[model samples]
Target: MTGNAFTAVIDDTMTAPNIGEPEEDMFRLARHLGLDIQGFHTFGDAAEFPQLQREAWDAARTALDRGLPVFAKELDLGNETSLIYAYDADGYYTHSWHGGKGHEGSDAVIPWTELGRNYCPCSSCRARASSGDRPSDGVYTGDPGYGGFVSLHWASAAEPSDARRALGAALDFALSFSRRGAYGWGGRTFYSGPAAYGKWIGLLRSNAIQSFYMGYFIDLFHESRLYAYRFLLEASEHFDGRPGDELRTAAEHYGVIAKNFQSLNKLFPWMQPHAPIDDPDRRREAVELLTGIRQLEEEGWGLLERLLTWVR
Candidate 1:
């Protein structure tokens, strides 16, 4: 319940706004979830780093050799994480979000030359090609040339759960999600918190809704809100009285958000947020839908903030 779903980030350009990258608070909360992760965010092409590459490769193999799974982010999964379980001279065998061939799960190997970079490191990496391109330059969405890897290892899975402490931390995160949490990278701007909704609306108003990244954003956030609702629902049981009531109400609002996002996902499946939305009428409809979502999220955020006061 680290309140990950509470924030949304996008850039001023409104390109491939991968807002899911958790910042300081989320990382701190990871400890509570029994995950001790070490990572690096690099701003150059990884192809030049043979020594570092070999080190990472050897580490993954060592982890696998010890019957442990190695974790890395933005490894051929369009700004997502991957689980490394096998490796050889060619590359690391992973179970990336983009499964199957061209990926690590069934038949994919992330070459040492490709790991550290932005989303869609190569042509074969993207699950599908978008018919739409940037109107400014007709460029399809591609990596912004930055990359990172977060090596994850199990810390203490057997540790007893601390519902109260976790709830307090999550409540703080949820409350802050609407106010702060801005980020930037590779000369690109990003907006998180409730402001992210406004960024989406702005993009919709621009009438240049990205086909691929837009769709990916919807699919990812929709799923996140779904989990937000479910987690809050379960979180209620750990509390008593008004705080519990407030959490339940907040959860209901998130449920609304999840349902609407599900509908939005259908409108923009996979990485096609601009599917039928390229049309003016449908685009206007999407604007309206996104506007409603923004309002609902803010209302839910308000409830969460209030719940924090009561719980504290």
Candidate 2:
């Protein structure tokens, strides 16, 4: 029940930065929730590949041996985060989306040397992923240097993650993140906060929607706002009187936000990212939903900013 919903992020392409980038915000969410994140993330330069593998190997081994779970990004099937549960001499064992696809559990060990390899080694996975609409599928050219790895483990909170305290911080984040042109993307080709909505809408109206990533945006936003609605409802009950009332009202805003995305998801009908949306009516409807969401979120920012002053 951490307040990460406050950190929802979207980019110009409608993918890549969802909830995971803007790294400092994630650290903020973890901090207020009283947890410490351990491990490292690195781009695999050829010279650093061996060191990256060794570091990840050591960390994963330590965590897994203690019966604690280990997690990694893109362990198999590009863009699919997975669990690093156990290990053996050959490599680290994993249970990710691939296991269900016939790889089976620990048997699908990713050799330690390939720890951060971006693409899949399997011919079928490579073939399908490369040809599919999934932009996350990086080509595994068998070069360790070209890969990237995100290895993570959790440690006990350094301080108390009081929900009451975190609420104030969350509301503060919601207000700040909503302001247009406030956060910088370091010259990267991306957008954040309310400006992101405008970028997304402008693309759709111009019939320039990248169908796969557009579907990705809708789906991710839909799920995040649903959680925001639920988290606020839960957080409301944790406090009393005006603070609680404000939170409940905040929940209502997110509830509407969630429903907005729900409508957008449907209007882009059939929910299949691979399928192109050719119907002009559906496109117009999607634009309306996005515009409505932008307005609704503006209201939410106001409500949350007010709540921020009194949360503690």
Candidate 3:
């Protein structure tokens, strides 16, 4: 997902100046995107001198002139995602999410983190974990070196040794925050309520994922047949004594329902505002699409009811 992108201050009074080269890129983009950029950093005669920071800042300003208001942080933190931030040249932040409380700006958690974890060891996590204290959420906020407002997002934990477990945990974390209306990916815009649910439906259709698995009537029937047998066995034996513990069965059952309702999911991708459906006619198209889904849902639910009665 594109993750959440925002502009953050290093502190109460900090503005863009205190940000190093890497951070300057975010500032530059904010300027390009016509966002407010206000932040400060302390710089003086240290061994690193002003050259490195100056070069980075200068380059960032150039990008700002070009109007690209987002940039990734160059720091290496041990997380599964890349960190990016945005700057508002005016330093005045406004986001639909906060309901006008205004944003100081925040970091962008890129999907690339998952990719990055495939290679390196996450240093931030190591340091935090080594302290013999349970770390707060993976979120790294305001390092002392950068003063208070410079927050960092640790790439999720995905190491070779326990990559599977780490990936699962990280995905869970991402999903938790994402569902709060903080992330978007694969050209899909997700929001609250049925908006996200509707987006998933559209995504399933436009991506042609169903064509690969749920296209043919026979294939769906076979799947349902297999699931029915399994479901019956589960019901009879009560594996783990759980309802729907047999995911293979439940998925197949749901998959059948989803396919039978394919037309419902299919209509939205073309109508919803989330997908590549960016024409000015968005609302009208969506309304028509919603009509179709409504019809299909009514019909689909009926089918589900019948199927449920017969299966059990």
Candidate 4:
């Protein structure tokens, strides 16, 4: 699916409040698409770990036997999704977020026993079809819409008021960063919204952030801005005409921001685990790029404000 379609269905606003948390996003999308997701039992300590692993294994085996991929989290790693594609008497073979350099299924092999140790307190399982309605092969045969996927084509024809509401939601989500409360794993305060840009700038100037973390922020914001650009472009379509000029302008500015983020990603290349961390020259260059990004983001926010005026 196009990013626009996916984000629209997933209801992503490309803002800090929702970014950096895939579990929430996955469940949101699943709910929007009408999938029923169930949380697994969370174990608090090593004593309870075996029960958690057993339950997860049973769920995974059930799903795999039906030719369905099992969704797992926190297996031999922390805070990422893993897809169990195959399993045997030894363990479950997964395609995880932490897989080594290779084709998807070539590496990630977590033994069942290992899962008891590395698995986090929380895990989940989901099935495609509802209870008795499930097919013999577990494949969904009915219309996908019945399974909860909203039709974006129909959404594109949304009324002006509905479109305006959506635009307003986007604006609110953007502004939330500055006002967002401490809401991250372990109560960490995230500098969100416009403040996030400033936070990165401060970190760069102080040389406080490690290379991997810096790279991760760059990658995350890059993806976020890219999504923002696409969302603005799609949103602009709803405002076609004289009133839409502001929307188009906003989209253009967001496109520039997206490009700037792309450049930053190239400079940092955070996806590489062994990327350099404490290079003064690279840090200086990043500061310059961030300054430019901050300016572009402010300009985009200004345009968004104008667009909101029209919509309001």
lDDT of each: 0.64, 0.66, 0.31, 0.52
Residues 1-312 of candidate 3: C-alpha lDDT, one tens digit per residue: 111111111111111112212233343333323344443222323333234344444444454455544232222232122323333332111111212223222222213222111111234334455875432222223332332122222111122323223222322332333234323321223342233334434444454223222123223223433443343334434233332343234434434444544443353332223234333354344345544543443343343333333323
Model 3 RMSD, rounded to 1 decimal: 20.5
| Per-residue lDDT of candidate 1, residues 1-312 (tens digit) | 567877666766566555334554676676667654444444343353444555666666666786665666545453555666676777766664454546433354557654543234234444343434321211113343432343333222334347777677777876765576456655556677767778778777776567676677787789889999998898888788887888888889899999999888777777563442567776677778888898888788778778777766
Model 2 alpha-carbon drift over 4 Å, by segment: 15-20, 101-106, 119-147, 155-159, 179-188, 273-276
Clashes per candidate, residues 3 or more apart or on different chains: 2, 1, 38, 3
RMSD of each: 5.5, 3.7, 20.5, 12.5
Residue 156 alpha-carbon offset, candidate 2, angstroms = 4.3
For candidate 2, write residues 11-38 as lDDT tens digits: 5554454433545455556777666666
The TM-score that candidate 2 achieves is 0.83
- For model 4, how does the per-residue alpha-carbon lDDT over 66-148 read when each residue is reduced to its tens digit? 66546654453333445667878878676655444333333435677555233321122212123333211111123322321
Instruction: In model 1, state the lDDT of residue 42.
Output: 40
Our model 1 lands, by Cα RMSD against the true structure, at 5.5
Can you give the TM-score per candidate against the true fold? 0.74, 0.83, 0.22, 0.58
How far does residue 16 in candidate 4 sit from its true spot (Å)? 16
Best by TM-score: 2
- Candidate 1 error regions (>4 Å): 17-20, 23-25, 41-55, 58-62, 88-91, 97-114, 117-161, 263-276
Lowest lDDT sum, 10 consecutive residues, model 1, at 133-142
